[model samples]
Target: MSGDDSLRAVFARHRVRLLLAVVLLLLTMLAGVGLLGLSGGFLTAAALAGALGAGTTFNFFSPSAGIRALTFVRIVSRYFEKLVGHDATLRIARDLRVWFFRRALPLAPARLGGTRTGELLARLMSDIGEVDGLLVRAVGPLLALAGIALASIAVAAAIHWPAAVALLLLLLLIGIGVPLLAVHSGDAGEAERARHRTRLRTLAYEGLEGAADLAALDARDAWRARVDGAARQLAGDDHRRRGRLIAGNVLHSACAGLGLLAMLWLALSAFQDGRVTAPLAAALVFLTVALLEVAAGCGLAWQALQSARISAGRLQAIVEQPPSVSDPAHPRPVPASPATLSFEQVVFAWPGESRRVLDGIDLQIRPGERIAIGGDSGCGKTTLSALLLRLWDPQAGAVRWGGVDLREVAQDDWHRHVAWLPQGAPVFAGSIADNLRLGQPQADEARLWAVLEQVRLGDWARRQGGLSAWVGENGATMSAGQARRLAMARALLRDAPLMVLDEPTEGLDVDTAEALLVDMAAALGPRSLLMITHGHLPDGVVHRQYRLQRGRLLEVGGEAQG
Candidate 1:
């Protein structure tokens, strides 16, 4: 869908809430008008009695009672209006966030690869905040203000047509003209605000990531200065935007005051000329003042709308990015027992890179074959593994599993059938059991322990509370070797038909790495293995090896000669 359409759809989702808020606001406004009418009626009766030279002692009591009752009713309606409007806005904000994030997930590690972590964080938090203000604070209040303004003008027209015209002009000035002026003056302020937030977040993230380096270099003062500079820029932007906001408020208030004076003056003249009575004039004046509050809300709401527009634009950019890999409209069902994997003349490159990472590559692994891929660091070994898992689509070829194109299979289905131990495998902050469950959530304690033993981590697991030990944040408490072993155990527990191991023993000691591989190979027994590494192969472990260079695959030793 187009970006405009997507944004419109987002707004449409809140249609029900928007309608409810409008309806409630209208009812509240009408109640306000009814109160105005009641006060006017009591005043009119008192004035008529005085004009006729009759006693008017009871007039004060009647108008006071009506004013008190109306005041109570207005308060209750206003409270409910706020309650429902805010609740609705929060719901819309939640839905938009969920929708944006869900669309973002599949495109990530590819489309999102180039986006900075801090920038993404800012979009997720600050940009989303703008959307909330747009939907709830801006729309609801504007709608309410419009409703009240129209109602007030209509009522005033019945009392005095000229006065009604004056009030309507004031409404236009406060509700529309002043806001437009503010928007014109603050043309790029919202975008600037979003940009500043993104920059600040990026700097903060960099500072945190390089805190150790800065300390080592004794550059703390420089870093602090940088942070302080960003803060000052942010403050400056805020100051300018708020200055415009204050100007808009001042203009709106001035307009409202002029409108109230015109209404009151007209009413007094009508009363003296016998065109209206005293009580009605008093009520009209009070209603005009109350309506001013709604006009003030209108000005604020306009500013919020402008801010939200910028926020939604940022969020929309993320949501509308075409997925690098998307599911087919009609996906083929994956086989229950696939036998082989193949890559046919596959050419791939990282986005924007001149050279193909994997050029015209062709390979096939028969069912249950143990294949090792040996290559230099930049020869695209990990990239090939990622393709096999369909993290990214090859630019000029296809990867097929069990004779079915990988693209044809559902992503979750493909992931389910293949287990992976990535290069620099991630160790999440959690217990061993918690980590293991990621591979197979239903795996029992016995199964978990068995996998740990298979990877030579069973001893470590035993010493560290077995499955229940805390790994600390990002496995910070664990040694590099221990973290690698734990990751291996987690991958092994998957028990899938295919396993792709990417430099799984890169950081291990010789003996530990050797022992772990021996045990892993035995446990993996006939499952198809595609292992990528530069390390020497253990004896009798790998049945075949392929060397990758310049995007070309060449078989080594016995396989090619045969």
Candidate 2:
């Protein structure tokens, strides 16, 4: 879907609230116009009546009552206007964030490889914030301005046709033409401004995140220069936008002045021709001044609309991007038989790369089989795991489960049947139990401690106040081995039929890595295990060993006891 369509759909979800907000805004504007007109007419009529003495009379009670009524309407409507408008905008802001997150999740790691973390953060915070103004600052104001302009024109027409024509011309030029011209001239610049803003945010966040490493490598100065460059670009873009806004504001003020002059000329001519009374002429003048607020609002609303369009486009780029791997149109049911994973003459390559990461190769592991595949660094061991997980489809042949092609089954269904532990699996900033609960949210404390014990983290958990203790940011408080094991514990708790452990013992000493492997073996109960490692696996833990070389899996050891 396009950005505008997506934004419309999001707003449609809360259309009632937004509609109410706009209506309230319209009422508020109308009240302001009415209050001004009534006050001017009442004061003018009272002055004329007093000057005429006993020769003329005026009804003070009626005009005074009208003035009081309008004053009450203005106050109440303005209050509700702000209350409802802000509520709608804030709600849409929250909903848009959630919507973007839901849309972006399936496209991660593969399709989003080129997207930076800081850029996405900018979209989530800044872009969404700008778009949130679509309801209040743009849509609501435009709607209210249109309504008030029509009402003001009709009131002017009641006094005289020339006055109405003058009001109509003013609304058309100042309210519509000026804003349209401003937006058309500034759209591209606004979009570019948003881009540079995102870039600056990305650079700033990256600098902060890597500050320690950059300092250690003596590259902090260079990183600072890059950030400064991005900031300068952002400032230039912002300055351009501000200049456009200032120009639009100046044009609007000029139009409003000309509009008021035209109205005054028309009102005076009508009063001399006896078509309008002195009080009515005064009312027309005051109404024209009040309606200028609507004109000013139109100019600001158009500027906001341009900014919102840019932000919407940014959000749309990520949420509407097609996933690298998509589910089948007519998905086959996941096979219920004991799971067996097989690679049948598979060939694959990364996008834009000439050489294949995996060649035509075939392998199979039945239920209860524990196989270890080792290879030198960069031999595509991790790529093999990615293919099996359906992160990307094989360019040729197929990875199958129980003789069914992986592509033939739903991705979620296939994932449910396998537990994957990739290298550098993240430990989120939460309690130990919170991290483990990701595997099984409903798991009790007993199960959590059991898995922790299996991964040899039970003692550490106890010392750290058990599952409730905070793990710090990304498990910072834990040792590298402990963090790795925490990730393993999460995977172990999943209890899937197929388990793929990629470098599970990475960063551990030989004895420690081997011991972890033994513990992993004891924990495996009738499940298929594919252990991809760069180092040695524990002796007798695998039924077979294959070394990946030149994109082919070659058996390097005889069948051994598990």
Return the top candidate by lDDT.
2
Please write out the lDDT profile of model 2 over residues 1-562, one tens digit for every residue: 5465466788898889888888888888888888888898889999999998977878899988888888898899889889988888889888898788878888887777779999999999999999988988788888888898888888888778788998999899988898887677677788788888888899899988888899999999998898899889989887877777788788989988988988888888888988889999999999998898656768778888889988888899888888889998999999984878899989998889989888887899999999988999998998898899999999999999988999999999889988989888999999998999999899999999999988889999999998999998878899887888899899989988989999988878888788888888888878899999978876778888898888888887543211
Model 1 lDDT per residue over 1-562, tens place: 4454465676687788778877777777767766766776676776678787755454578667777987887888778877877887788788778777877877777789778888888888888888876756787768777787888888878877877888788778878898888778564887887788778888898898788899999998998898888888888888888888888888887777777888888888988898865766776787777677656667568778888888888987886788778788888988776488999989998877989998888889988889999989989998999899888899887999878898898898888889899878888888999999998999999999988888778888889887999899768878887788788888888889999998988878888778767877888867899999988888867788998888888788633311
| Model 1 misplacement above 4 A | 1-14, 25-54, 57-62, 185-187, 213-222, 336-338, 505-519, 534-541, 555-562
lDDT of each: 0.81, 0.87
Best by TM-score: 2
User: Candidate 1 overall Cα lDDT vs. reference?
Assistant: 0.81
Q: How many backbone clashes does candidate 2 have?
A: 0
Estimate candidate 2's RMSD in Å: 3.0
